[model samples]
Structure formats: structure tokens, C-alpha cells
Target: VRPGESTQDEPNQKWETEDWGIFSSKVRYAAEKQLDTAPLSQAITQLAISFVGTTYTPGTLEV
Candidate 1:
């Protein structure tokens, strides 16, 4: 949400659900491409979950 935007109007405001899904999908896709013979789907899913658990703040390091 943009500056001063209220969650009352945006159900997914504070959660950033779309970004999480997109990031998870991208990670899974990359893992699949890199480990084609032995698919890393489960691994990617776990890693994504772990990452989402971390407390995130603006300007923090990524990956």
C-alpha cells in the first residue's frame, strides 16, 4: 500500500500477499530449472516459508 493508505479498504494491505506468492513462484521456477533431474519443489517451498517467517523491514538485505 502507498503512503498513508488504510488497510480498511485493502484487505491484503499489510500482508503483501501478492509479493510473497510471486517470490515463491519465482524461487520454485528457478529451482526447477537448476535441478531439472531432481526437482527441488519441496525444498523451494520450505525455503520460501522460512523466508516468509523472517521479520522484514524496509531497506533490509534480500536473499
Candidate 2:
């Protein structure tokens, strides 16, 4: 699905079908792409804040 990819291939279709939940619901199925404008640090901070009070194993991806 880079630039000129075909969907007629069976393997490609199978992989897409296998992960249909995430792909179909969340993904924006279009041929165009754009740059993300939001800053990475800010995004990470916002996401980390959500887990600030949650008890996760001491230091493993817990905010």
C-alpha cells in the first residue's frame, strides 16, 4: 500500500481481513497521507497523564 500496490493479491487481502477490527474502525481508508501537526512530547504527556493514578507494575510503561 505504499505508492502503487494492488489489492488483488491474496496474502495482502488475507492480512487485512485478519486485522479488520482495528483497520476498518480506526483507520482512515484513503490513498492520501499527511503530516501530524501535534508535538510528540505534548501528546506523550497527555497520554501519560491518563495513567498517572493507575497502579501499574512499578516502572514499566506506567505513565
Candidate 3:
């Protein structure tokens, strides 16, 4: 896919507690640190880097 494209067919995937925690923390951190002022690519790269070493679980997106 393209740089900003999602491979998932569904756009409304459910978010688990862990996902929410991570997302909220990222959002809060971004707001506190003014990450929104960064270029989109830079922000995306930073976010992707944060996921480094994260374990991939099959069927985690099943709903």
C-alpha cells in the first residue's frame, strides 16, 4: 500500500483496552510535546517507531 494507506479492509476495527491506553498516551504525549506541529511524515514515522518490537497477534482484528 501507499505510505498513508491502510491494508485493513475494515475501517471500524474495535479497540481493546490496551489499544486505548497506548492511543491515549500517544495522543496526550503528542499534544504535550506539540507533535502536531511536525510534518505528517515525521509524525507517522515517530508513531511507527513507537511500535517497534511490538508483538503481532493473529486474529487480533477479528470482530
Candidate 4:
């Protein structure tokens, strides 16, 4: 498979309901604050910082 691509038979990363909620909130906040107008790096940094303290599971992409 191509980079970051998974097949139907492979185990893939799954987002829980809470994860979706967090994503939705971030998208809404970004829209409301017009973060899209900011420089790409700045916007990416802002979004990355917002995930502080989030739980991360390593090896999720491993087959």
C-alpha cells in the first residue's frame, strides 16, 4: 500500500466518539476564530498546541 494507506483487511486507526467530539470542537473553534486566514505553520501550531494533554496510543499504525 501507499504511505498512510490501509487495506480493508488490515487493522486501522479508529476514532472514538469523544475523539470526534474533540475534532468537531476544534474545527468549529478554528472557523469561528478564522484560523484558516493565518499562515499555514501558525495555524498548524495552534491546532497542535490545542491537543496538549491528550491521550496518545503509540503503534496505532502498525499492522
Give the per-residue lDDT of model 4 (tens digit) for 1-63: 344455467647455666567778999988876899999998998888887997878975466
As for candidate 2, its clashing pairs are none
Q: lDDT tens digits, residues 17-41, model 2? A: 4345434432332112211344777
Q: List the residue pairs that clash in candidate 4.
A: none
lDDT of each: 0.58, 0.43, 0.71, 0.75
- Over 1-63, each residue of candidate 1 has an lDDT whose tens digit, in order, gives 444344676553453566667567767765655544544785566556556756777764432
* Model 3 stretches astray by more than 4 angstroms: 1-13, 61-63
Candidate 2 segments whose C-alpha is farther than 4 A from its true place = 1-36, 58-63
Off-target runs (Cα >4 Å) in candidate 1 are 1-15, 35-63
Clash pairs, model 1 backbone? none
Worst 10 residues of 2 by lDDT: 26-35
lDDT of 3 at 42: 83
Give the winner by lDDT: 4
Candidate 2, overall lDDT?
Answer: 0.43
TM-score each candidate. 0.32, 0.32, 0.58, 0.59
Clash count of each predicted structure: 0, 0, 0, 0
Runs of candidate 4 exceeding 4 Å displacement: 1-15, 61-63
RMSD of 4: 6.1
